[model samples]
Target: MNTNYHYMRFLVSPKTADALSLRQAIQNALVQTFGIVGGSIYLDILWVAEDGNEMVLRTTKEDSTKIVAAVTSASTPRISLQKESSFLPALGSTSVTLDEEDL
Candidate 1:
């Protein structure tokens, strides 16, 4: 319900990255995109999947665009944005229909 913030979900490629790797990647991307200022931006990792391939991140609305751009721009250990929303609950909803294999 917080409109001042944005939530994002990213899925890691190869499905083998850990939380630390994801954090480092994001930080590196931010730094690469906007130098040290961007790298210092405040953000929070709300949740990381048990498999360590998916995570939910929280940041200010103004910084959301920068974050999305930074994350997607990174090449190594590819990171893809799965979802983004102003409403935190919206990120919890599944956009894809689950198959038996996923269940």
Candidate 2:
């Protein structure tokens, strides 16, 4: 199976911007356009980095075509994306039992 990922990194000046709106735009695009199924925003960890900028999002593997089309035309205009490699390990080598309660 092919696993795809997308990452968007933005550089913003703190005093000259509203980070909330930017995040909203991205989140809206993810839901309305790309059809992202699940994730979380670490807002408390948002901050200016070593370059005196801030970071907001990190999404798991998603459809590349959808992701690109969604954010490319967003209002924020500052977000940029990068694709990364992800690895998954097999959980078990045998069939596992599932009880009625498990379901």
Candidate 3:
């Protein structure tokens, strides 16, 4: 096994009624922050149920630390990370466990 991996998926719940906008803001932050990284990376933002108030994000990382730092810093009073995970393919990753203790 190469033991190399990259992928992250998380949910964001904003305090406001505009989920889609919140998602866009976060996506912009990620791209702006990580676009300079050398390795090819990908980001996907999904708005929950078209309500424009809840969303999920999937990111393929060249570096998890950078992504985490960017997201954490970009988060605002109206937006917060609900759940997230870092994957390592070299370890044969499977699923992300969102534990009660995570909160």
Best by the lDDT measure: 1
Candidate 2 per-residue C-alpha lDDT over 1-103 given as tens digits, one digit per residue, 9 for 90 to 100: 6544333444443322455655665567657764556312322213324543544344444543454566565655444443223332221123589999999
Error of 1 at 2 (Å): 5.0
Best by TM-score: 1
Q: What is the lDDT of residue 95 in candidate 3?
A: 62
Residues 2-102, candidate 3: write the lDDT tens digits: 32434444345444446456546666666666674532345555334354444454554455556566667674623444444553232233468899999
- Please provide TM-scores, in order, for all candidate models, with all chains considered together: 0.81, 0.38, 0.42
lDDT by candidate, in order shown: 0.83, 0.45, 0.51
Task: Please report how far candidate 3 places residue 27 from its true position, in Å.
Answer: 3.7
Expressed as tens digits, the lDDT of each residue in 1-103 for candidate 1 is 3477889988877674477777788899999999997577878888888877888999988888888889888887677889998888888898688899998
Better of 1 and 3 by lDDT: 1
How would you order the candidates by TM-score, starting with the best?
1, 3, 2
TM-score of 3: 0.42
Q: What is the TM-score (0 to 1) of candidate 1?
A: 0.81
